[model samples]
Target: MGSSPDIVSPSSRIRRALWPGLWVPVVILLAGSALSFSVAKRVSSQTEALAQQHYHLQHQALVHLVLEHLYRHGNDVSLLKVPLAKAMPQHLSLRIDTLERHTKKPLLQLGSIHAPLARQALRSELDIGGHRSMVTTMPDAQLLKAPAQNLRWLVLVSGMALTLLAFVLSLYLCWRNHQQRKLVQSHRKDLKTQSQKIANLNVEKVALRQALNDSENRSRDLINLSGNLIAELDEQGQIGYISALAADIFKQAPSDLDEKPFQQLVVQVDQRRFVECLEAARADQDITQADLALAADDSEQPVPVTLRLKALTDPVRGLVGFRLSAQIKTRPHD
Candidate 1:
């Protein structure tokens, strides 16, 4: 019988095999991407922290310079102007207020002292010329923003690379699975075709055997009395019939051997050789012989036998099946 087209197709089976494995790379890619994002976020956070620290240090330094200028010039506001302008960063505002050390009362102030509030700021206090003073500074937002943006781009690029790697690996695995599935499907198709051929051969054998039995009763009687096991095997290697002597030799009822593979009665090691002999007989249309070990119903050890195979054929059907005969080989002691 011909195999159904769908059953023989490898595409669907390949897809089925690939589907379960596909998620492995997807999960890995996603996890890798998440890890990359987390690392970038951490780095951005660290950069922001360092930027804040730098801003604080700049503010402290500006406060120190202003205090030093004030002390040198005896709290001269004009002398402090140049140093403050030079030390402060752009887009930042600074304020300095001097207060009484004991009463905490403002004694002097410099700069505008107040500016538009920003999202980021720092404030600190210092003692200058026996007066406690406060310094407040607002940092430029770009200090934190630029590095964060760079980290984001880096993470994006890394995520894309990881995704691409995962995709390539997935494709490779799918392709491998497809190739393996195709090979398996091809092998199955071959086996199915061979089975169909064997079934056809069995049908022809049945017809030929029936014809032979009907045409010659003396030949049947001679086969039965020959003291050798005679058997007919179908193309699929099933026993179509076994002579009474064959059943007695295996210690099995004739009915038990019917429709069973002839190989079941042979020892496992010799079964391959026996099948090769049968195939040779089929190919050459001549008898082939092989030394085989036949299993008996009551014995653990197989009985040594010389197996013979002959192709049975009908003029109309060509090679029908195989006719197998076995002669037990006796030991030297026997």
Candidate 2:
């Protein structure tokens, strides 16, 4: 029987994918580091190597000059050595390990060598060979590597600048996040303040409505307590509101007379008096009096009443309406 293939779990596959993806960035970072290191090493090598030709030519010139000086001195070795050692460049160390042809003496060594010296770019030998061999060696390292040091300083400065730039970006993002939070908090506070104000205004509106209702009820009670008929009229001399006693005097339901003309309740002969009383109230008279006969539609005889009218004026609109109080009069004599 064939073995079944292994089934990978969903979570295992997801974890595998994520872990491998993480390595992509890691590999890129490693590549970048390796590239930087390679470039730095290349810069150092180039700095050391660029001037090799120049140094070689300079070395050849010095050798030729030394030979020329010796020939001019007629091969007097002691006379030639003193001035040559004094005229040598301060930055270089020169050594000649050779024997003279006839005297068999070892040649001169110039410049001090306190440390072990391994780096030497050029080595040569004089034609004073066969019996005596002359060797010359020069190290071309000291001031030639100054360019490499300057390159190192440039790398360090660039790294420091990039680090400072990253630090400043982090601070700016943090400050921006902080400012956004503060702005959100400010908006929330403003909304809360607006909501509180709206709630207070609603409370005030309810209080005003309750106060108006109370005042109307108090006025109704005062009129009922006076044992008289009272009616409130609009600017058109229409009954806007009336006491319950008005139903008894008008011989009709208060609802029936509501918004109906006041002239409808007066006798035909005295209906002119209704117009006169309304006009007097609109004229800003304090209190006006009239004698009128009140008769409803089905009444056979009219009842005589003394009607007193008062103006209801508004500051901006002048006279808006009137208030009428009626008292029924008894028959004077038999």
Find the candidate with the highest lDDT and give its number: 1
Q: Please give the range of 10 consecutive residues that has the lowest summed lDDT in model 2.
A: 16-25
Cα lDDT tens digits for candidate 1, 1-334 = 9988768467776766564466767777778778777877887787778877877788778877877787888776567667677666755677766654445443333334233337676777776567576767765555556666687668767877877787778767867777887789899999999999999999999998998877667666887877567889887779998888765567678888899999888888988888889889988889999988887755445678888899888899887788888877853121
**Candidate 1 colliding pairs:** none
lDDT of 2 by residue, 1-334 (tens): 7545697778877864442234444444455455556666777677667645555665676677666666676544456567767666544555555554455444666665434235654566655324343546464345455566577556645644554565555556656665676688899999999999999999998999899899988988888888777888988889998888766665678888889988888889999987898887777568898998888446445768899999898889977888999887843221
Cα displacement (Å) at residue 114, model 1: 17
Clashing pairs in 2: none
RMSD of each: 18.5, 11.5
Which residues of candidate 1, in runs, are more than 4 Å off?
A: 1-20, 97-119, 130-133, 191-334
103, model 1: CA deviation in Å? Answer: 19
